[model samples]
Structures are given as C-alpha cells and as structure tokens.
Target: MPTLFSKYAYYFNQLCEFSPNRLQAQKAKNVAPVRYPTPVQKNMNLMVDFKVENKVIGYSLASKQHAHGNCLVHFQSTINRILKPDSFVVPRETVAISICNSFFTLGSSPTDFVKTKQGGKPLPEDSYFTYKMVTKHVMIVLYNSEGAEEQLAGFVYYPQLLTSRRVCPNIDETAMALARITYSSDNGPEMFARFCKKTQRDVIVKIMNGGMSATHMDYNYILLEQNYGSCSECNAFHQEKMKKEKKEKKKSITEKAASKSKSKSEAATATETANSTVTPPPKTAPPKAVDSDDEYDFGN
Candidate 1:
C-alpha cells in the first residue's frame, strides 16, 4: 500500500512535469515531451487513506484521470469520511437556537433558511438545521438523527418570537413541548397565541413595553419594523381591524352627505309647491259691491 505522503509526492511530480511553465519552456526549446493518451498510465485504481494522528479518518478513491493542456490531473472522490479530533461539532440544540437568533439578527426568511439545507451546497454555520414553514406565521426546524432519519429539532412561532424576543430554550424539552403543541393542529399561530395568552402574556407585555433593556428592545423593534411591517400577530390583527373601521366610518360619512342632499332637495320642492298653490287675495271689486248693499239695508 502506498502511503498518503508517497501518493501525494507522485501526483505532485506528475503535475510539475506537465505544468504550464514547463510546457512553455519546452515550446521555447522546440523540444516536446512525449504525450500519453491519459494523465496516469498506472495506479489508475489508486486509493489513498486520510489519517489524523496515526488513525485512518477517511479515504479517497481516484475515479479518473484527465489531461488539462500539459497537466495530468486525477480526480478523487472522498468516501466514508469522519470528523477530525479537533473539529467542533455544534450541538443540535445550539444550532436550533442560533437559527432562531438569526431571525432577529439577519431578518432571514424561512426560504433563506431552507436554501442552506440544500444538497451539494456548503451549509453556513447558522443553518445546520432545516427550516419548514408550517404556517404563515409558524416555522419548524428539523435535523438528521444518527440513524439518518429526519427528526423535529424545534419550532419557531415567528410572529410571537419576533415580537416578544423570546427564544426557545436550548434543550430537548423545548422541542418536545413545541412538538406536543403543534402535533395535530394546523392553526399554529392561533394555538401559539392562545398559549402565550394563557401563560406568557405578562412576559410578552413586559418585553414589548421595554421592560427588558430599553436600548436592546428599541434595536429589535427597529429591525422588526424594517423587516416585517408589524412584528406581532396582535399588531397585525389590530391593523386589519382599524382598516375595517376606517372603511365603515368613511361609508357612513358618504351616506350622511347623500341623505343631507336628499333632504335639502325635498325641502326645496315643498317650498316651491306652497308658493305655486298660494292664490292672490280675492278680487277687491267683489268686496266693494258687498259693502254698498250692506250700507243700503242699514239705512232702511
């Protein structure tokens, strides 16, 4: 078996011989090195073991060799990899909490979170878990267990969490609690709202009112406003209600104006009718003839 160092040395020698500089020098000298059909003729089935501190951690198999100009390159695919001893593996709970914190700090959407879990892409440190938007206002996190099974890691009720700045505890119990609440219900936001109303109302109100560090609370509100117009479900609901009331109030104003105009029109019509029906005083000649007849009867 070739040692890892020996294999590396062989590849390095092959690369140097066919390097661009070497090719240029050969062309200048009018001397061409013998060309081979492929980069490496022998050791095509080469396997190199990766070791750390005398222990094999992983291995790579040379799949194929190709020629790039004058350089012979072997492409190797790593297999059965293991983390090095000094590698820092973040705990699943910590990853879940970091994701929740990112919502506040980065204003990252659920879609952004999901993109990080995509295969063949290098996942960012903050995006180890998968984000699933279970509802408009609710999201959940998932992680792969040791058995390679997807398991629920945590949940994020964005509206409440963003508004209250309350993150889930970095414990399995928190995930369990969230799972229990959301297991069978689709109305996640409403259910979460009810839960908060029953148990966390005071804490939420305190946070919202700057009972926490006022400066920190203000900063969060600024970010919330910039990212999502209204941070809380309560605020969104109130905004909708206000809009409805405004519409009703406007409709009432228009109706009152219409009624006033109609009343004015009817009053004008009545006035005109009274004036048209009025008759001039009875002719004066008739009154004069009655007076002369009455005077003659009195004299008699």
Candidate 2:
C-alpha cells in the first residue's frame, strides 16, 4: 500500500500535468454562436485573492510581470488571509484560482497594446505569465509545481494546437494558447460544468448588454466551442453598443460637416452679393484745388 505522503505526491504530479490549461479548452473543433471574433484585451489587470501560509492577500495584477505589479492590498491582506510568510506552502487549489484570476485580469504588454490587440508574440511557458491572444481576446494562466488535488483543486486540459499561434488563458506561452480549462473539479463535475457554463453565459450577457463589436473571426470561434470553447455571449452587449456608437459618431460628423459647409457657402455668397451691390467711389478728378485758385484770381 502506498503511504499517504506518496499518494499525495503522485496526485500532485498528475494535477500539475493539467493545471489551468487553455490549449485544450479552445480547440478549433469546438465553435459556438459567434457573430464575430472577440477582440483580445491582453495584459489587463484581474482581481485576485490568495491564502499563502496563514495570511490572505489581494492584488490588481498587470500580468505576472511581478516587476511592479504586486499590490500593497494583496501583500498585506494575503499575509493575513493566507498562512503567514513563515508558514509552509499552502495547497495548490487555494492558490491557483486566485493567482490565475490575477494574471488573467492584467493587460500589460511588452510592446504597445496595438500589437497585442492583433495577437503578438507570447511569453515562454517558463515565463511567470504568458499573453495568450486568440481571435480578439486574451487571458493568462499560471503553472504550479505543488499541491494540485481533485479533492479541492481541478485538473487542467492542455492541447497542442497547430493552427493559430494563440488561444485562451495564455496557453501560447509554450506553443499555442488554444484554450485552458479545468479538468475534474471537486464540487462535482456537473457542478463545475454548470459553474463554467454560468460564468460563460454571464460574461457573454455582460458583453452583449454592454454592447460588444463583431469581428472577422466569428466563424472560427463557433468552430472551437464544440470541444474546446463555449459559445457564451460574453461581449455581445458591448458589441451592439460599440457599433451603435460608431454609427452615431459617423452620423454626427456628417451632420456637423454639412452644417459647416452650408455656413461657409452662405458666407461666401453674402460676400459676393455685397461686392456686386456696392459701387466704387467715382474717380473724382483733382479739380477742387484748381477751382479754388481760379476763384481767387477772379477776385484779384
């Protein structure tokens, strides 16, 4: 019989094999209802809370850049929320979710965000955080060496992608970020599935209600949701709003231009009309001086 310690070690190894893998979650074969491809908002800061030793910390991550991303709130709060810094390492499940969320929310980029918006080169797998850009979206996921357990933590599905160089949850760091998703979660697979479903739905509804935009890569997204992706309308609301805003802006500009042109034309016409109506002063000869001198001579 294997000792509990050995059993845990084996479990940890298996769990690490699939921790928050985006590659498997977003396979091209699984597409869903997508009017267009979602835009990548890579390097955006995510909200995360963690339990270290016996203390808990929260932070607004700008990706795992860690250079200047640590939040005082996280450091202080985490110290209290998690085990104290002096305490030993905490369980992986306790750390993964919070850390993953923090990294995902960050939107920092090596270059200008413009390139990241178009799917830029990703960081290495060994990198603290990788920017996984696919379609028009970006997310981040991290790997942990210890403490992954199906009891409380979940397994991650990672896929080797061949098509686009980008995926979701920052899988492209190693090769391609296809889509990182949880394996078997403890709260019952169905429950976790439902949770994911709800999350996707909520995000889609949020986007749609907020008015998202359509993109050129819609068809591909629908293709992936079949196996790797979910067809949640995360940004639908935003899409509509964006399109509406764009149209309104264009309309407003056109109207303003028309008004300006009309005013300009009216002013020009007024100038021309004034010039045509006015007559130049008759060229009055310089006869006044001569007439004065003649009058004086007559008197003399």
Candidate 3:
C-alpha cells in the first residue's frame, strides 16, 4: 500500500501530465477550453483539501503537486511561479480561518483533523480544503440564537481542537443561521438580523473590554465572520454590494437632473407664451411697399 505521501505524489504526477480537453468557447481565435481531469482525479486531489466554516476552500495551485500548509501556498518563489494578483487568491489569514470553521463544526477531534481518517466517509465538502486535527483542543460554543424556542443553526467547537472555526465565528454563525432560516423555515431574516446584531455587540464588547491584547478570537470583524464570509469571494460580495448602492445613488442624481431640466424647459416655454400674450408683440414689418406705381416708370 502506498503511503499517503506516495499516493499524493502519484496523483500529482497525473495532475502535472493531466491535459484537459480543449473547448472552443469563443470563435475568431484559435482557442480551446482547457480540459479538466475526471471527477476521480479531482476527488483524489481533494483528499488533502482544506476546510473553513464547514466550507471547502480550493486554493488555485501552480501545479498539481499535492501540498498542505506553506507547502500549499499559491506562489512558489523557487519555481518562479506566479498568479495574477487579482486572481481569486485567498489570504493566508483567511485560509487559516476557513479550516478552523470546519474542524469545530463537525466536533471531530483535532487529532482526527491532523491524521487522516481511514475508511471514514467524510462529509461532502468543498474540494479546496483539507483538515489536520491537532492533539490539543478547546471547545467554544457560539449560537445563532440561544434560549429561543427555535434555536437557529449555531456552532460549537474548540480552536486548539479545530482550525476552521477558530478564526471567524461570527461569520459562520451568521451564514449558518441564515441558511437554516431560509431553507429549513426554522428561522427568519429578522431572527438572523437580531442574532447578528446581538452577537456582534457581545463579541465586539468582549473584544473591546479585553484590552488591546485581545485573543485572536475576541476581535477582528473580518475574522469574526470569516466563516460566514472572509475569503476573497465573500469580500467581493461585500464590495459589489457597495458598488450597487453607489450606482443607484448616481442614477438617482441623473434622474433628478433630467427632471429639473424638463421642468425648467416647461417653465421657460410658459413664460414666453405669457409675455407674447400680455405684452404687445413686436409690430410686424411694414407691408413691403407696393412697387411704387407712383415712383416714375421710366418710359411713362
């Protein structure tokens, strides 16, 4: 039996040699779609995928080499590897949070996260993430809503035990709570909004009161919600929302200008008509002199 490392190495060999079928997505150019590996190949790669907030985050890789942690980082200095800075690259901090979110949510022992779970039918997860369970552990319970007749989806876990939930508790709570409310009909938007506000207030206050040396878990609005949304994609969502609002405001201003222009035109037209009606109109030019019959005709 190949060791995990050996198996990954084998998969990596395949990934390196793996060529995707070319697809002609656009015309007018000699271009084809890059073929992706079979599901089997992708799944095999996911064996080491990382998790965040019960979400799997796939890091765009420079190669098919199976790697985790710093080994898995996006760019390779030695390899002269590069990715578009704007590419969907996640920050290291965000990556860390994503893993924490998943580990704690499952209540899986940190040790399990660290070691591979053989014959374990792992839950369906994102393809981008892998988990490593450490031996030490601490459990923290965060609620979507607690002491409510219908408790919304919340999280419970220990950071020393799990990495995914450690970085961003608020974000995950907000997301899961909303999901439960939306799909399950167990909670509502209002419930979520309230929960978010209260929870944010609580967490923020705790952080503030704790002084500057607050625990990583105690502060960072972003870290708090990393599980809910901290990855680059989630941040994009936030940015897009702001852009939409700005567009709407600009549209409103344009509409107002158009409306004002129309009003001004109408008023000017009305004033012109009033002036013509009220004030004497300029006298029409005197009728052109009749060809002066009286003016001597030369041959008369």
Candidate 4:
C-alpha cells in the first residue's frame, strides 16, 4: 500500500505534469461530490472530494490558491505530509459570534444536511445572490484531531462571494449568523482592532504615568482603531501645559520691559536733579579779592 506521503508526491507529480482533463477525469472517477449547500450561497453546493488509494482516506476541496491563507492549498502543500493515511479525519468545532460580513465553517465539511429533490421547482429569483454581486468572505481553518492535541490543519480565506443575504432584504438571518462568528482569535480586521486597543491603552497608561524606559515598542501589532493616536486626555494635558508655558514666558518678558523702563526714568530724574542743584560759581569772591588788593596798595 502506498503511504499518504507517496500519494501526495504522486499528486504533486501530476500537478507538475499539469493536464486539466486528466486531473478532472481522475478526480471525477476517484472522488464524488457530496450535496452540501452552503448557507451563504444556496445555489452553489459545497463539495468534498476524497482521495482514494484502494479506499477513502483523505478529503480535499479544489480551491484556487491565494496569497493569504487557503485550507485546500495548504492541505495539498503541507498537511498531507504529516497525517497518517489511515487516521480518521474530522472538522474542528467553531464558536459562533457576530462578525459583520464573515463566517466560519468547521472542518472541510458542513454539518447541516440540506437536501435537494428531483424535479424540484426553481428557487425564487431573490433566494440567492445575483451573478454580478459579491458579498460574503469565508475563512476556513483545518485542524488534525488525530493527535493528542489538535494541531493546525491548514488556513484558507475566500473573499467576496455573492449571496442573497448581502443582496436582498430577506437573508437577514443568514447575514446575522455569519456575523456571529468570533473575531478575537483570527488576525482579521476585528483582531487587529483588538490589538490596537490593547497596545494603545498600554502605551498611553505607561506614558501618562511617566514610564518611558521602553523606547522601542512592538508597534507592528498596530493597524487602525478609534481613539488610538489621538488620546483626548493626553492631548488636553499637553495643551494645558503648553498654554501655561506661553503665559509664563509672556509675563517674564513684560516684567523685564517694565523694569528697564523704570530704571531709565530713574536715571533721567537723577540727571535733571543734579543739573538743577548746580549753583553758578560764587561771583563775589573775585571782587572781594580785588578790593582787598586795592586797599593794601593805598596803604603802601
């Protein structure tokens, strides 16, 4: 019997040799599509195709590879290398929380059984999304439960799938359901918001309390959030301090000018007083001396 690694190696070889027809034909013969209708898109049924080596062992979805995460791509690229071919596979259980425009599915398979009957009437025009519109984003995370601890299986994200929930007024419940998926765990927009709150609060609290020892902070966790950079209290405090400094500076300048003016006035007043008090030289002293000389000359 070929091991799972051997089978994956064969698949990779097949991928390199790339024949669309051969791959599809092989898949069609070896795999069967299960009738699983996704809640987001009623028209499109979710299909699971399992790989067989003498018997069913592994399952995968034929999904387009994305730069972000995609479970199918990761499963083909990495997960198959680790798991035993004979280990029973199951989907991970996901908690439902309200997240706008997104939803999560446990495992590669869906649990709810929505049936299709033969000769069924066509669904109403409003029952699904139109061909032109796209609405929902999906994140598929896979886990290997065969081990003592559940290990990460693979990661996949689907962006902009059109659904009736997004298009019409009727699928409110569907939209609500997808929104109910928890955003705390995944590193999506919601998780980023959470990160922003945590980091912002920590940084603000530290700075306000005068803890500046941590010069280099891990700010990669920052993306976007409300009241992050523009903290109201911080802004107000700084503004008040700046205003106080400006007022003190102005006061000092005014006081210096007043003192200078007073000193100049006092010097001018002293100069005027000295000039007014100066008496003319005693004019009579010379006349008296001349009179005395004349009297002495007569006597001689």
Candidate 5:
C-alpha cells in the first residue's frame, strides 16, 4: 500500500505534469503525453482508487513569472469498487489532497487562501488556526460525501465555531431587554418583537466583527475537549500578542529621562519661591551698642 506521503507526492507530480507550459512544450516537440478524462489508479486489498478531474483554471498571477500557467485538479474518491466497501473509511490523505487542490485552483497567494468568508466577514490571512479550521471542515464534507457548498452554507452568516447553542446564551435576553426599553407604546408587544429581532441581528454582526480572534480561542477550546494536549497555535498566538502588548506598554528611556528632568526643574523652582517668600528676623544692631553704654552709666 502506498503511504500517505507517497500519495500526496504522486498527486502533486501529476498536477505539475498538467501545467500549461509543460503541455505546450510537449506539443511543440510533437510528443504530447496521453491525457485522460479521469485519471485512475488501482491498489491492493482495503484500497480504493481516486478519479481526479484535472483542469487549468485561470487566476491572477501573483508574480509575472507565473504568467505561464497553473493547474487545478479535483480528486473524487470512487469507493464503490473497494474490496471492503462497508468497512472502508476515507483516508486523511484524501482530505490533504483536496485542500492542496483547492489551494492551487484558487491561486498561489496568501490572499487567495483568505478569500473564504465566514459570518459575512472575509477570512484573515493564513495561519495555523485557519489552516486547521479549513482542514477540519474539509474532512467533514469529504466523510459525508456532501456538497461543499451545502456544508459551508451556514458559514455565510455564522461561523461553524459558533454553531453551538451555548455560545451566546444571553442573546435572547439582551435583545428582549433592549426591545422593551426602546418600545413602550400601546403596540408595545408588536414593536418589541420587531426590535428584538433587529437587536439580535446587530449583536450577531458585532460578534462576527471581533469573531476572528474569538474563534481562534473557540477552536482551541474544541481541540482541548477532544484531547488533553494544548493547541500550539493558540500558545503561539498568545505569546505573540504578549510580545506586542509589552512593546506598547513599555516606556522608552528618553521619555523617562525627560520626565525626571522636568520634575527636578520644578523642585528647584519651588525651593527658590519658598526662600524668597520668607522674612528674615528684624535687625537688632543699633540697640545692642546703645544698651552696653547705658548699662555702664547706671552701674557708676
């Protein structure tokens, strides 16, 4: 049996062969390789072949050098012919290949990977969290053999991470409170209903506005539930955030020095003002000389 690594490598090589430049080069030499509508391969017991539909999809080239061409291949597993169809499970290799195919089909750029929109918000740039989330979703879709569009349709308005009922436990209560406070007329009941709905929508939008970062935490929580190990992505994100916070919070040496100098100058000015405001004791100079002469005459 071919190892998972071998399978990925095989598919990647197959994709490269279908590159437009390579095809054109072959044609120019009058030695074009045979092409198949569905490329199939056989495996021994407990094995199933994947029939991949290959095509070249046009995308904005990330660089001028890539203007030559790019290939997009979609792999569909045909498990109907598996020796043990009832017991067979889709391999992780299939999921990995699907991700790779989707990536290349879109474009070879960070922006291409970020085109997916979650909760009406465009996904941020690629990261470990995003990569794992994408992989998990793809795995689910493949395992169920469901249309990716149907499985991902919910994410159009809300993220999969927030699918649980408990994520926003107070949403209804908060909406109700807002509605009651805003509408206190004779048609209060009807107005309350409308207001509540609007409030709920607004809350969801607000959550999604900050959802990207929150979702990272949620993803890690889910992973923790499954196993005791900590998420490396979450750890790395936290460490990076700490680094940024420290940098922002730290005072520069120049600022400290300036503050010290200002304080010293103010102290000196205060001391001078205090000294000038005081009255020295009145002079007793002439009285002392006269008192000595007067005391001598009285004694005589």
Candidate 6:
C-alpha cells in the first residue's frame, strides 16, 4: 500500500498532466516577460486590483496583448476557467451556463440564465444583456459563428457585496430602490457621474468606445480572442466572396482581350479602304507644244 503522501503526490501529478494553465506556465518559461506601463488618470492613480477575495493570485497589469485580448479590466483569477483536454467536449455556451449556475442563482435554478436577457426594454432575443447593465457592470463578451450576438462570457462579483447583504437586513430594499432609479435613467455621462468618479467614468467610456487610442505608443500589442480564429461562417463567407471576385476578374480580362482583337480588325479594314481610294496624279501632258513655240512655229 502506498503512503498517504505518495497517494496525494500521484493525484497531484495526474491533475497537472491535464492542466492547461500548467502548459501555459511551461511555455511562459521560454518567452520573455512583458511589462506594461502604469496608467494614470484624474486625481486617482488607476491601477489594476490584484487582490481578489483578499488573496493575491497574480499581478493584473494593463496589457493589450493578454490572453483575452484587449480586456479593459482583466482579473487574474487563480481558478482556471478552461476545461481539461481529456474531459468531455463541452460547448462554450454550456460552459457559460455552468458558470452561471455555480456562481449565481435566482429564486429557482435559473438554468436558462445563459439564454435569458436581463433588461427593462424590449430587445432581440439573442442580445446578451441590457445596454444599461453593460455600462454599469464589469462583464465579459463571448462569441461563436452561429450566434447572432456575442454571448455573456463571464462576470465578476464582489464578495463584499454578499457580506454586506448578509449583514444589512435592509440591503435588498436599498438595492431595489437603486435598481428602480437605474432603470428610470439612461446610460449617459450624468448617470455614470452619479455612480463613479471622473477617472472611472473616463476609462469606462474609452472602453465602451472600443478601446483607448494606443496608436502613438510604439510597443503596444494587438489583442485577439481565443475563438477569433475559429469562425466557420466567416470562413464560408470569405470563400464565396473570393470565388465571386475571381470570376469577375476573369470576365473582365476576356472582355478586354475581345475588345483589343475587334479594334485591330477595324483598323486593318480602314487602312485597306484608304489605300484603294488613293489615285496617282494624272500623268502630266507633255509640253510638246511649248518646245515648238520658241522656234519658227508662227503657226498657220
């Protein structure tokens, strides 16, 4: 029989063997470390909150080239959200649903939370969230080729809010009041000013406007999502578009060649007609009469 320590060690090794993060970590060893410049805004020196749940998992830096690709707010959570390679294949939407079920709940299971929309106004069924909620909350966007809109990937929740709810009996009522106020208002600068300070407002605005301008910076990185390269619909559309473009190009070339050939035939015919119409100058009548005029041709 194996010792207790040995058994645990074996289990740990087995888990590491299937760990995606472990593989990434090994890859990182060979790659150079990337450093990001500290961002400063307004009176507040804005920095990524590395402390989550009061535990330091990893440093959160402002990197445009992180794994998630240009995430405005990246929290390096200790937990790995990726599924194991050997585990049964799971759809991304299914994974999103599982995360929702584990972390949040409504009065019931809220199993359809992944498919359901949360907002006051009517919207397309595929929309992930209300525009207002997105402006106010920290959220992640996930997408696949088939979905009409990007799906809700993940969300961060503050444990402090839960603690406050547990301690403060009237927290629900206060929350309801806030919710009513939020719903009544629009997602504008004024609304954001009420909830956030100047720096937060500016950062969120830039993010909502599709990332701040980093063009002036020399070493900025390009961000891309994991599934950015795996869009079947996009691939098919590109194929069809290319085929149409190629056919048009061939048709244009053939038309040009035919036009040139026709022009050459027309030019030959014109040259032949012009040559045939030309008549040599009538031969000059000899000046026989003039020669005799100088002599004794006083003519009778």
Write one digit per residue (lDDT tens) for candidate 6, span 252-287: 999999999999999999999999999989998786
Better of 3 and 6 by lDDT: 3
TM-score of 1: 0.22
Estimate TM-scores for all models: 0.22, 0.25, 0.21, 0.21, 0.20, 0.24
Cα RMSD of predicted structure 2: 20.3
lDDT to native, each model: 0.32, 0.31, 0.31, 0.31, 0.27, 0.28
Query: Tens digits of per-residue lDDT for model 3 on 1-300?
Result: 569887677555543332111111111022221222112122233333433333322322222333233322322221133123423444332212212222223323221222123367563342222211111111122222123232111222221112222222233233333333333343321222211232332111111222222111122342222222222332333346457878999999999999999999999999999988896668888877767666667776
Single out the weakest 10-residue window by summed lDDT for candidate 5: 150-159
Over the stretch 1-300, how does candidate 4's per-residue lDDT look in tens digits? 479887677556544433323322322112322223233332123323423222222222223321222222332332244334533332221111111111222232322111122266642332211110112322222221232322122222232122211111111122111222221233232111111233332222113334212111222211211122444454444456557878999999999999999999999999999999998986554534456676677655
| Per-residue lDDT of model 5, residues 1-300, tens digit only | 469887677556644533323322322112221211111111011123322222212112111121111101111122223123432332322311222222222233211221334468543343211111111111111111123221111010011121232232122122222322232232321212111131121111111123232112111121111112233444344456556756765756667889999999999999999999999998775744457676678655
TM-score between candidate 5 and the true structure = 0.20
Tens digits of per-residue lDDT for model 1 on 1-300?
579887677556644533334322322112221211121212222323211121211112233321121111000100112123433322111111112221222223221223223456554454344544432223455543243544444333322111222221111222223343434243232222121222222111111232211111011111111111223544444346457878999999999999999999999999999999999986655444457676678655
> Model 3 misses residue 195 by how many Å?
16
| Candidate 2 lDDT, 1-300, residue by residue in tens | 469787677556534543334333443223332322222222222214322221122222232332111222222333354334432322221212122221122222211011111146563443222123232222223322224321101111122112323233222221211232232222221111211332332111112222333211111122222232334442343345567879999999999999999999999999999999998888966755557676677655
The deviation in Å at residue 6 for candidate 2 is 31
The candidate maximizing lDDT is 1
Clashes of 2: 78
RMSD of 6: 25.1
- The TM-score between candidate 6 and the true structure equals 0.24
Q: RMSD, model 5, all Cα superposed? A: 26.1
